[model samples]
Target: MKESGLPDRYENDAAEKLSPEKQLSPEQQDLKNAIKAFCIAHQHDEHAVFLIEGDAGTGKSIVINSIFNEIQSLSRSSDKSSPFWKTDNYLVVNHPEMMKLYKNISESYPALKKKDFERPTTFINRMHKSGKKADIIFVDEAHLLLTKSDKYNHFKQGNHLEELIKLARITVLVFDEKQVLKFKSCWSQGLLKSLVRGLPCQTYHLKTQFRVHAHQDVLDWIEGFCQKKILPMPQKQTFDLRFFADAQDLYDAIKKENARYRLSRMIATYDYPYRLDGEDHFIREGRFTLRWDRSKPDEKLPWAERPDTIDEVGSVYTVQGFDLNYVGLILGPSVLYDPVTDGIRIDTSRYEDGAAFTGRDGLQDPEGTKERIMLNAINVLMTRAVHGLFIYASDPALRKRLVQMQASRDAA
Candidate 1:
């Protein structure tokens, strides 16, 4: 496999690429500067929102971190004329794993403290109880913010973004509609626009794919598959895309890659049984059997970064918003191939993540909504690979179709 042209640290942890000291592409730098100007212009405005829209692997997190670091620096500066002087700001993420990364990244910058990083619920409740307002608030993975009340997380309010806007002078967030995985956090472009309808808002889209080394056709193939269309595999070879007939072979390939590249690991759809309770849940395929990711009370690293995680299978919850140098994806029982329609099908009945479907009471179409969430989970898992993507399907028909597609591509 060819090198991804990224530093080793970035390959090991996706959050490392979001460091303020890292270099950004020309387009990313320009977006950062524009956002800074927007924040400065609206520093005292009644309400303002800047939405940074992009797909996975578009370097949205890097831009958000860079802009937040500059905001912190200017706020602490002694210059009296600076608009950010003596201002208060915070960075929030809805995902716990991603929050862990942001907090770890804070140790490298003197201007950014671990206190400055918080989960959305914690930040919202803090501001609400204290009646304290922030000057600028940066949100990463805004799509994961709760759209409905999730009492388990202690977010009584229905909309997190709305409450966040009320607590800040200016709110900047990165959103990808495809990454919205659950009914509670369900988001659409229309819903997002509705929230900031009356506020002074600006939207910017980052089109370039910065994390994945694959060509455009390869990405299109992945997107088409997620949309239930199995298009012909692309013939170009800039990135590695492979299909394995057996689960053991896929695991062996991933192990070889992990030994050579250091960040390769296997991840599966939430079709298999798994829960947060203290018990071992295993995914057994043929001769291959491995346990699902376990919570380690004393472990400081995220699931993907933990040294022992290579021996386990990760789910969307643990790997979303992160990158892997090479990812071995297991398309579990819920994902099926429909021979009649010559398309993909999502069997929601086999999906084991019941929490994802909780609170679907008012949904206009519960079944359709569930299907979309399942597809979104598959999309997030497929797009995580930085250099290569290896796939294995548990459904026999799907596995056969994928193998035939690969064979045809090779023959061409």
Candidate 2:
């Protein structure tokens, strides 16, 4: 993996991997070809949407990136017979950090330009104001697209997916319902399908696991935990899954892993207080106190790539959609163990990230939705580790239960 927490296949120097037929798994290659065929067959269609659905680490980004690279290459080719010749195309991602990584990768290839990447809001407003439409548009992290009008983001159109489909002849996007992190950008499979109901649309589901090398049992354990089922930790000798009682010990272990593996870093849930006010904010858990990641206005590298960030704790906003060799996850106070019910409980009142719950007033079962969002945040943080996963929970009962689960697995 690259220092930026991206897989080496996506490194700027790995330009050859961007080719459609190179370095892609069979599943990824098939999806890329399918998307390519869809775009060509529907080039003149009024509106077409191709939805790629996959869990985190299923190589959705790889497929989309390769397909976009091929599109750009063919569009700029001298062959006039090529259907993609001189086609106006762009790639937009809702996350700023992921956008930086995409722009960085674009610099290494001649066919791609840094400007080809944009935020969904920027691309939407720009196209609206300029009265220009793209031939094909690729959206990464489409799950982050705003489902409702977010004035804070300067997006008044309400639904970004709907607008993107209108502004492009064919819109290809990757979505994961599990990764939807906030109420403002909340999305569901049914809602996504409803948006493209009248349009020409096709869906593809990727089942391969390209990111996490852990066993199927380990993945199942994580899924069960995220779904509120506290299952026993699986025994996996190849993939390290450790539970730490002390937050400081978890941080130390993560640092050692980073020394051995360049891409390892520590991340936490949004249970700590933080803001982008150009000041330092810290996640205080007993003796383990580390500052939350800050927004670097002039930094070109992603949060995990920067050398100094090793000393900080990353939130979902910084590490989502990225890879890390080893991840030390700090589950904050919002996550608790309800012994009475013998299940996991999410204490929504303890969550410090109020922004996540903002604009959730009209939503059905607002409290339940908020709880699910919190769980999703934990799911994203937990899945970031490619090689190993180390966890520290702030709630004593929850941490004790996790320790017991690990102990039982070790005994077996």
Candidate 3:
């Protein structure tokens, strides 16, 4: 009897009841104005830099887009002779795409250097050299900024973010530090923080979550790790686990219902499949293809290019920037649960080394690192669903811990 296509629940009600400005917290509003003011003031002061940092679902992208709009408005009002090309003023640097996502830039900004536009690094550098330093530069998912290393040669390690800082007076780098799921050499908040250390930079934190309904209670759980303590798990029995269940049953039900859930967004976090013993590749209840086509340098092997099916399920790494109406998560053994310590651990040794865990077994880690990783991965995975979450736990103890955590928080 469940009708679906994402949740209508209170999402529309919330939107209808709240004005756009009212939707944002006072702090968020202040930050918006401050950002706008900074751009207006530093429009003439090239090399002035600004940084915006916040965790996932914090409206970072929204803020960046707003500032870009303001800059465009201001540019049109200014003299036409300005050397800074308006088209090049707003640069979005992100990972390489199999699909041609940057084509609009070529058509919209004909002045863009054809050669440089193909690569993020080259395009960013060319814009920097153009002397306008871009009135504002917005980098999405910036936590993935590469630090200098042998593996990545596209941009100088450590310098790419630094150079972006140097190139623009007002640069807003929006990313979630928690998303630094992988501890790569290039991972350093210090590089970004250092750039705006002493300047007029005032860190603005957006803690109000507009994404999930107040009844959902997931935000309360995620607050355990966010920088701003604005959201803490409220002790309430109002938590709803009605839509969640074991991965197999959940997938079967979804398939039977023929509901409206994207296959790609239904994700799974498996324990190290490596120790499973016999299987060459693992398959879950849902329909999905697992291919180990020799992992590409930047792409994860056990992942897909994009959401191609309505019943898609993928690993944590593949679902970072995506979201869905309902999420079906198969939590594998990559995360270890220590019953004695009541802690979680994430084994990352085989992550970059291309170790494939194809069996029912998982990996091992001495420290609680694997647990922490698993917890973080769960946080990310569960948050992806706007309406519902279905988690398939391979580890019973871990599942008990999660349920207990949810219960204790709700009861509190």
CA lDDT scores, all candidates in order: 0.88, 0.86, 0.48
TM-score of 3: 0.67
Q: Which scores better on TM-score, 2 or 3? A: 2
| lDDT digits (tens) for residues 272-294 of candidate 2 | 88877889999999999999998
Off by over 4 Å in 2: 1-22
What clash count goes with each model? 0, 0, 33
Error of 2 at 243 (Å): 0.4
Q: How many residue-pair clashes does candidate 2 contain?
A: 0
* Residue 391, model 2, lDDT: 94
lDDT of 3 by residue, 1-412 (tens): 1223344332332112222223445656677788777666666765565566665655665565444544554455455664333534654545443112232223333233223223346655576567655556666567655433223445643446666667666666665656644333233456567766765565566765544433534565444422212233344332223223355676665453234333324456644342323434444434434321122334322233333333444555555554444556665655555665555545544232232212112223323433344455667666655545556555566656565665666566
Model 1 regions more than 4 Å off: 1-12
The alpha-carbon lDDT assigned to residue 85 of candidate 3 equals 34
Ordered from best to worst TM-score, the candidate numbers read: 1, 2, 3
* Superposed Cα deviation of residue 294, candidate 1 (Å): 0.7
Indicate the worst ten consecutive residues by lDDT in candidate 1: 1-10
Pairs of colliding residues, candidate 1: none
